[model samples]
Target: MTATGLTPSTQGAPDPASQAAARPTAHHPARAPGRLARSVRRNLTAHGFLIGAVVCFALFSWYPMVREFLLAFQKTERGRTTWVGLDNLTTVVNDPAFWQAWRNTLLFTALALVLGFAVPFVTALVINEFRHGQGYLRLLVYLPVMLPPVASVLLFKYLYDPGYGLLNELLRLLHLPEQQWLQDPDLAMLSVVVAATWMNMGGATLIYLAALQGIPGELYEAAELDGAGLLRKIWHVTIPQTRLILTLMLLMQVIATMQVFVEPFLLTGGAGPEGSTTTVVHLIYQYAFSFNNYGAAAALGLLLLVLLAGFSAAYVRLSRTEEA
Candidate 1:
């Protein structure tokens, strides 16, 4: 204490520890490494997860597609590769089988849409109505889809045999004339479509069944109140509700049927009678494997790609227009 003051005030003085705590320290330059390391680790982890898929797509899908495009313009002849320019395209277009293959592919797509699209929807509708055994019925329908494709095709071949096939036998028993199923040019494509529809329709049928189950029962009741019959109810409520799914399935069926090769190849020996079953894909197979002409095969494949792309674009445009 001073003589004139009771005590000296420490209120304005700063604490040494507090001042030191608040003081800014010099930059170490080491923290940058720590932050950079953390960023690198995070990026590495993310890329590690993505690398597998990237590699797989690069190896299997993208590489093959790019190779096919290259093969379209290049030719391998007598252990030498040479650029053929548009010669391969010209050759593919000029081939007599090319147009025939397109025609057959289109026909197959049309028939598949009718049978594959309609049969599944109808089957789903019928199955949806069953109050009992729906699960068992669905299982039965899906069983064929689970079968080995080769085995199914072989079984169909035997069943389609005109001489001793069960179908002809049934017709004969009914006093109907036995008809050649796959052997006749006129019926071979139809036979293939029927078999394909039977084999592949299970998944579509189940999808439609799910769609049907999602429909509001109140809508059906309202429809009934309006005096709408069964067909009218289907048209007014069911079909409209399921239109999107139907359109998707229709596009899927078209693509599947257009690329059809295994069924017709195994059923009617690739070319069918008089090349009636020679679809575009089958023709491509013949070009690549049978004739050992990769360039021609690629060219034909490119053509099919263009056609399908155009068809899909037109369909989407039309759908949007209708929606608008």
Candidate 2:
């Protein structure tokens, strides 16, 4: 022991300043390489899994879109390709069918919104309110969607025939006027929309049904307590609750009906009487297949793509804003 009566090693506490100086910092330079290496390895593995999808999109989707764009600005003749600037676009824009196709497309979209959007929603509501036989009703509603497109279109064509069709026969039996369905230029587009709604509405109905099942029953109870009638309850509680799905479905219907082709092609020979049902997509098909003018087809298709893309972008922006 030292003469001061303390062990030699216990004579003084360690220096706090020296201990603090010896401690490691949170972001030590020596540990950075290991962390960076691990991050790079993880990213490489993730990208490896995405490689197949990237290749497929590049080969199929992106390449075709780019080719279509290029074809819109170029012409092929005598096994040669040459840039034609805006010639194809100018030709397409000048065609009278161009405006008619746009008008028909817009009309079809409007009709589809009314039928495709509302019918499914209302059907869903009815189906949801059912205390029994829900499964059977759902099956009946969805039966049409299971049919092949060609089969459904042909079936509707038979029904819309002016003479000897079941629909006309039913009208005769019911004492309703035997009006021309597909044969009438005025009603041709409407008939096509009806057939389309019948065939495609099952999907939307099922989607709406799913959404309806998620709604809280308390909302309805509160609406009832507030003396709301059926329609008022729907307007105040149901629509607001399902507004997102409704808007999304509305946009989807617009896009689908705008590009409608198969029903019109099969039912009305692509243009009906006086070119009534000639849609933009049908016109593109005519340009490409019937007239053998791929340049014009691509140009028209590019325009349609641009317009639809704008709508989609607007929807995306609105959805984002709502989320924010």
| lDDT digits (tens) for residues 275-317 of candidate 1 | 9999999999999999999999998898888878998998899
Which residue pairs collide in model 1, if any? none
* Candidate lDDT values, in order: 0.92, 0.92
Tell me which residue pairs clash in candidate 2: none
Off by over 4 Å in 2: 1-49, 318-324
Give candidate 2's TM-score: 0.84
Local distance difference test, candidate 2 = 0.92
Q: Flag regions of model 1 displaced more than 4 Å.
A: 1-47
Clashes of each: 0, 0
Cα RMSD, each candidate:
4.5, 5.4
**Model 1, total clashes:** 0
